[model samples]
Target: MAQVHLRDVVKNYGPLEVVHSINLDIADNEFVVLVGPSGCGKSTTLRMIAGLEEISGGEIFIGDNVVNDLPPRERNISMVFQNYALYPHMTVRENLGFSLKIAKRPQAEIDKAVDEAAEILSLTPLLDRKPGALSGGQRQRVAMGRAIVRHPDVFLFDEPLSNLDAKLRTQMRVEIKKLHQKVRSTIVYVTHDQVEAMTLADRIVIMRDGHIEQIGTPLDVFENPVNTFVATFIGSPPMNLLNGVVRDGAVVLEDGTTVPVPPGYQAREGQAVQLGMRADNVMPVGHSLPPTEHMAQIEMDVNLTEPLGTETLLFAELAGAEVQAKMLNPRPVEAGERMTFQVMLDKCHLFDAESGAALRG
Candidate 1:
């Protein structure tokens, strides 16, 4: 029953503020991820929750207790850092049980906790091996096992997979998700990777420049981004934005190409806006998804093609800006080839050109 609550937390170094006052509540046994680009204050926020960094203002509550004044050891939390901080000289079992050992816990209790954590992470076979003897993924598992042996009220993971290779990172993502399902602990993970946030979190907290931009379930943020920054940051290949002005129930681009404003948006005539389109929403007519009721056709010359097995990402220029569209059904097309693509207007978005806020009715 460890629910974490941050009440307008703020962090400042001397006179410069790094983390603006931000509030968040994480439910018990929930997995939440704070994701953003580098220098977004995500890791600083996690460290504040862990009591590793002192808060400049506001209170932090772990369950029913105010932990703002508590030290790291008294916060009843365990943190798994990016670099697997395993002692080189200790075997896997010793490393897992080191915290409890240092705390002067009974040998029987320590052994039981270590054994259970080892079994859970499938590290029972590597208990006798040192960190140097284990692979990166195996070492990460050992790091997680060390955190689990403590059975703390909360688990904080700070980019725990960044050091691993691409394949191992994918594998570890699955492992971390499975671990959450098994342990059911309240987890607050921090990462700059959106894919990890989307795959691992029950809810995501997106931050920028020390301020929280948005917080919602992955699908909620993906399908309904609140602004242009979020619309571009949450998805791979980024969303294509075309600057235009609303005129006669349509958006007119710089090149005199007019497209109907996406449905549900109340745009005034003569209003400046940016039309947002994901690569998935724009595709070659023959290779596109089943047609939607509200669609717009546009012609563009392909500049490049990125064949990704079942699908290819087509790069083109639209309205003076580079645009990315997906090509389904697998086709070979030379550069500079002209193609007509369909845009799913129902899935498109409209944002205020100046402020970057979503234009919703």
Candidate 2:
């Protein structure tokens, strides 16, 4: 029953506003992530929810109560930070039970909570070991175990995996996902990594420049980005964009390469636009996916090739801009090799050149 609601929330430092008035509704037990580039007010917003930062304007509600004035400790929430923040001298068990110990909980209660958390995080064998004795991933597990021992109604994670190595980050991502499934607590996580947002969040709140850009499920935002920023930001390698103009039922690229406009888009004649396509949607004919109803064929010379195990990522120039295309079924094409590629028109996008907004029908 720990649903969180932010009503026109705003955070200001002196005269400069860092977080603009924003509203959000987080249902109980939902795992929501606040994600964007550095200084986008994501962490600030999470801190406000955690009662770490005082809101300059508007109200915050946790469950049925207004918690705008409550301190973080009094809000029944636990936060796992980027730094492990474990007591160096304390054993894993001691660290896990420290918060409860400070609260003067009964010894039996402390033992039970600590044991449960250790069991959940598979830290039972490390209970006697200090933080210095644990590996990076193990230390992170201990951190999570400490948070779990509190049995808080909500969990706030502020870039908890940023300090870990790439491999450990991936491992911890799985652990965190499993933790969410087991705990079933309302979680508000903040990170600048879109991959983390895509993998961990039940819904992602994409922010930019102190304002929320979009809020939706990961796939919802990926396949249907509302603007150029999101189209380029949410996915790896980003969607390719090329300057173009709509002319006679086709989009004419900068170098006079004409491609049929994508399906289901309302493009004005003679309007400046940017044609968008993802590497997955553009592929060499023999190495392409099943042919779709609406497709455009184009020829380009491969400038570079990244041979991923299953598919190769072919880099080529289109309309004077570099565009990435995927090559399936394996290929050993040298640089400067000419190849005909099929563009999945239904999967492509068009954005207003001036505003970068999607052109939907």
Candidate 3:
């Protein structure tokens, strides 16, 4: 295991700069996931760390050694690609042992490494099978096994489970977590899936347009996003953002209804602001409650409801903006009916309409 560090790292292709100055420190044996939308430069950053892409500027260090001039192999790092990158003609055993053979390890050593890796990945049963005969999940396991045999200082995974079906994706997610616990190697995984980022990463690096938006644990980003973009990105059904204005120390919607503001909100009266709230925090009010400093009331028009086994997802409209609410043990609700819901303003967020930055108290 090793600590990976990047300082002002940049990646450019000819005239197009894909990744801007990035600074990060990944501790030893930590699993850090880089997550963002497509073309957000998450993969580009990972490639740069693996030495697969040239770093246009800044320094990269692996365990106190500067490796800007080193090749991928020389960095002593292993990368598992999305497509598995297996040789179709080679059997699983041969594929896993190929690197050992190229490094001139003895025949016995190669066999031992391959066997151990296969055992760890549960690929021993398919050792003689070629890539042509393996399922997508099996092929991915082979790719992981290839990385394990070398025992590299760091493991880089580029959406390795993307090619599998939904069921297999869930199954393999568990397998990958288990593998990491057993190996305890430093890993950097890149993906666009927020669920994967939330479930697997020790900390998530959220990116946008080649820049880091927020770096924190999953709960931190989900509960307190720094901007509107992040508030809309990290949630499942996403947070409901309503266009409102700050007036008299509260947020007033377009329909003239008001919601309370938390203590830290410093918006001036009648100033334009966007109020952000989570779906899970939107609760249906069964009775009248005293107005609190951290609470706001709203009328939601039910558009649709989706039953998701344990909970119901309610689609509604508020202040001409689409909103969603997640309710536990939700009763049947009819469309076109006005339902009263309370917004937990203590958990609410405020963003500047123009700059999109969260309004600091």
TM-score of each: 0.98, 0.97, 0.96
Model 2 lDDT, residue 308, Cα: 92
Model 1, 56-153: lDDT tens digits are: 99999999999999999999999999898899999998999999999999999999999999999999999999999999999999999999999899
Stretches > 4 Å off in candidate 2:
none
- For lDDT, candidate 1 versus 2, the one ahead is 1
Residues 197-244 of candidate 3: C-alpha lDDT, one tens digit per residue: 999999999999999999999999988788898888998878788888
C-alpha lDDT values of all predictions: 0.95, 0.93, 0.88
Measured by lDDT, the strongest candidate is 1
Model 3 residue runs over 4 Å out of place are 287-293
Q: lDDT, candidate 1, residue 351?
A: 92
Model 2 lDDT tens row, 182-255: 99999999999999999999999999999988889999999888889889989987999999999998999999
Q: Residue 7: error of model 1 in Å?
A: 0.9
TM-score of predicted model 2? 0.97
Sort all candidates by TM-score, best to worst.
1, 2, 3
- Model 3, global lDDT: 0.88
Instruction: Say what the RMSD of model 2 is.
Output: 1.2
